[model samples]
Target chain A: MRGVVMYTAGDVRVEERDDPKIVEPTDAIVKLTATCICGSDLWPYRGIEPADHQVMGHEYVGVVEEVGSEVKNVKVGDFVVGSFVISDNTCEICQAGFQSKCVHAEFVAQTIGTQAEKARIPHADGTLVATPGQPEPELIPSLLAASDVLGTGWYAAVAADAGPGKTVAVVGDGAVGLMAVLAAKQLGAERIIAMSRHPERQKLARYYGATDIVEERGEEGVAKIKELTGGLGAHSVVEAVGTQESFMQAVGATRGGGHLGYVGVNYDVKIPGIELFFAGIHTLGGPAPVRRFLPDLIQLIWDRKIDPGKVFDLTLPLEQAPEGYKAMDERRATKVILTF
Target chain B: MRGVVMYTAGDVRVEERDDPKIVEPTDAIVKLTATCICGSDLWPYRGIEPADHQVMGHEYVGVVEEVGSEVKNVKVGDFVVGSFVISDNTCEICQAGFQSKCVHAEFVAQTIGTQAEKARIPHADGTLVATPGQPEPELIPSLLAASDVLGTGWYAAVAADAGPGKTVAVVGDGAVGLMAVLAAKQLGAERIIAMSRHPERQKLARYYGATDIVEERGEEGVAKIKELTGGLGAHSVVEAVGTQESFMQAVGATRGGGHLGYVGVNYDVKIPGIELFFAGIHTLGGPAPVRRFLPDLIQLIWDRKIDPGKVFDLTLPLEQAPEGYKAMDERRATKVILTF
Candidate 1:
């Protein structure tokens, strides 16, 4: 089998690798149909996060090629979407809807490279959700997104409490941020503000339900959000960028007693306690429990209620995984889909 | 009139000062019935916070001495209990139950100290809640506790979502943390764990409703909490101390999908982003919006359903305020009350 791995920072390679087989009774062998490079993938590619022969993709939409005796939820020839974080989904944490932090949780990106012909999925019944049936050719991209990006963005909106009567502010214009705007609109936010400097991304943000756009960053951006919300910041804020400036801007943009949902945080960032204390808002974030929302999101995609696949601006074959990484690393593509 | 003032670190004095008079249409002059030294007061006295003849207290219960023309909610001779922070209550923030961050918010500790014969209170109608009538002499201390400590602890419990079937862990043993234990009990939490090393405080904690006591601090304390909760940590955690260790311990003691409500944050503590990001819990904290809880708290105190005044262990005449401060600073008293 062929798969992707990083020999070192900025060095992604697509090379022959031994094929994966069911290692446990709960495992299933997945023949990946589609996968993608993520904003988080850039962390290792840019050397901001260490990468030494590290396995790559965590998101995938695929067909079950083989299943162990105990794998009851998914079987051979079934189309499935799985969460980035593996979980049994029966633990107290997972049952509480925080599957990402399940007692048996493991990050797929750290253990399996899904940007390959095939991979082994553990806890198959709990982590993988089968679509109602085989998906249409056009729905593959959207189904792939349901594995991570779309579910994550939806979680961000839910955490931010973005709904009717809410004025939501999104800080970032990347794929996840744009997805968040889509989620906010779907969640019925009264007003949506996207902070982006790029005209192209800003246009897409508006297309996804952003009622206004601010081309500023940091303090100035917060001021603009306040100005738009009548001297009170937005009632809900989603932070999709990991930088210190972006985090603080998101914090400042949320009104007192509002909610702040953040994702994509960097290891180097440190939040001053005083600032958060004075801001006085409810905050909930971290690795999203994508599996919890996979069932609903897949249905939404299948019914054409949402088109999250539009976030994929570039596409390539699995053999060209290196180019996919490079494109995302250089910001040439908002997201890149890889076909096996 | 006489008031308590800190001349410098480790120096407190009771001296003659101008009697307060109504300054704004919404202002009211209150003759204090009782005032108490807070855990936060020790910060300035110990030189951790800057103090230069700073007027001293925030928590108080009193009789309304006078009111400006526009003051309607409270009037002269009415017994009242007021929040430490003044707010107009009509602002959006206040209406949303965050009166601490109201548009017209002002800290009484920063401006008019309440530890005096009489003090001027701004935003009288919004900041002060009148009791149904003059209270029995025995109720003065409990009513004073409602001004800050009791309200703050209640807010922490509410923010952490303490309720039936939840396991709550309190990270501080000060008056506020002890009050939090009481609050969690009243809020119907199934189990309450109080973390404290002091024998006396632990006894009081047990009396107030702590089902368990973990004398360990920092990481070990977190381990004890997890051990008690079947390795999942507590469902709700309250951080009543502001130090770095206490803050981190509070975070570590909360389960993945749990809630952490913090109060009394120091200015210098910086939370590492990676740690918080990985903790994956909901957080809501800051200076509590005491005014929002004033009415209910006053009612409870009036009905004698709770005895929050037991937190005050030392009582001294107004002229002996300096000694009261010394007792608290030297750890001889958990809390000190001052009287005219």
Candidate 2:
């Protein structure tokens, strides 16, 4: 199997690797149909997060090729979607809808990188959600989106409690932020604000049901959001960018008693307790329990209720994985999907 | 009028001061029946927080001596329980149950320092909750407790979602933390864990329905909580101390998907974004919206359903304000009630 690996910063290579087989009774081997490079992937690619010959890719949708004896929910020859972090849904945490922190959580990227021809999935019954039937080829991109970005955005919107009569502001124009706008819209938010300076992404955000767009960033951006929401800030704010600036912007753009949902993978962020205390808002975040939303997201995608796959602006063959990584790193593509 | 003022660290004195007069149409003059020294007061008293001859206290239960024309809910001669922070309660934030961040919020400590013979409570209709009737003398301390600590602890427990089938862990051993145990017990928590090293506070915690006590300070305390919760940590964590150590301990002691409610006046506390993000817990804190919970808390106290006044381990005349501060600072008292 050919898999993507980053040997160093700005170095992505697709190399032949040994095929994976089910080592555990609950495991299944999947033949990748679609996979993508994530915004988070750039952390390691740009050397912001350390990596040495690390396998790339966590988002994946595939066809189950085989399953070990104990695999129960998913079996051979089925189209399925799984989360970035594999989890045993039976754990106390998982049962509470936080599968990402499941007691037996296993990062698929660490053990079986999905940006490859074949990958092994552990705890298949708990991790993978199969479609009603083998999904049409056209549905691949959207299903793949549900594996991470869309699920993450959906969770962010949910955590922010974006619903009827609420004004939700998304503080990032990336795929996840754009998807959060769509999630908020789908969740019945009366108004959605997408804070973006990019015209192209702004257009997509509007298309995703954003009622307004604020090009300003930082304090100015927060001011614009507050102005838009009658000087009280938005009822719900979704933070998709993990930097300190983005975190503060999200906090600043939230109204008192509003919910601030941050799904960004934070780096070097230090939230001052005094400011947060006076902010008088509810904040909930972390690595999103993506698996918890997979079933609903998959159903929505299958029914064409949402087109989250629109986030993938660039698609490349597995052989062109390096370009896919480069295009996203340089901000030329919101997301890059690699076909196996 | 006489009021408590901190001239410098370790220097508290009851000094003659000008009488407070209604400045806002929403203000009311209240003759204090009881006032107390709070754990947070120690911040400035110990010189951890800056003070330049600042007036000392925010908690008080009093009789409404006079009311501005616009003060509707509270009338002259009414026995009233008011929040430390006066709010209009008509603002969007207040309407959303976050009166602490009300657009017209006025910190009583800064405006009409409660540790005095009388106070001018602004936004009286919103800030003051009238008792069913003038209470017996014995209820003064309990009503005073409701002005801050008890209400704050109740808000913390509510934020943590303490309820049936949940295990709640309180992180501080102060008045607020002990009250948090009571709140959790009242909220129907299946088990309550109180982290305390002092025998007196531990006994009070048990009296307030704490099912377990963990004397270990930091990491060890977290480990003990996890051990009690079958290795997953408590279902709800109340952080009544705002130090970095207490914040981290609260986060560490909560299970994934659990809630962490914090309400100590934060001083120089910084939450590491990375750890909080990966913790996968819900975090909600701030200066608690005590007014939002006042009516219910007052009713509970009036009916003798709960006795939060027991947290006041010392009573002193208003003239001995310095000794009250000293006793609390020396850890000789959990709380000090100063009778005017």
| Each model's lDDT | 0.92, 0.91
Q: Which lDDT tens digits does candidate 2 get at residues A121-162? A: 999999999999988888999999999999999999999999
Q: How high is the lDDT of residue A331 in model 2?
A: 88
**Which regions of candidate 2 deviate over 4 angstroms?**
none
Candidate 1 iRMSD, 1 decimal: 0.8
Estimate TM-scores for all models: 0.99, 0.99
Clashing pairs in 1: none
What would the per-residue lDDT of candidate 2 be over residues B234-325, giving only the tens digit for each residue?
99999998889999999999998899999964667888999999888898888889999999999999999999999998999999989988
Root-mean-square deviation (CA) per prediction = 1.0, 1.0
Q: Which ten residues in a row have the lowest lDDT in candidate 1 chain B?
A: B263-272
Please give the TM-score for the first chain of candidate 1. Answer: 0.99
lDDT of 2: 0.91
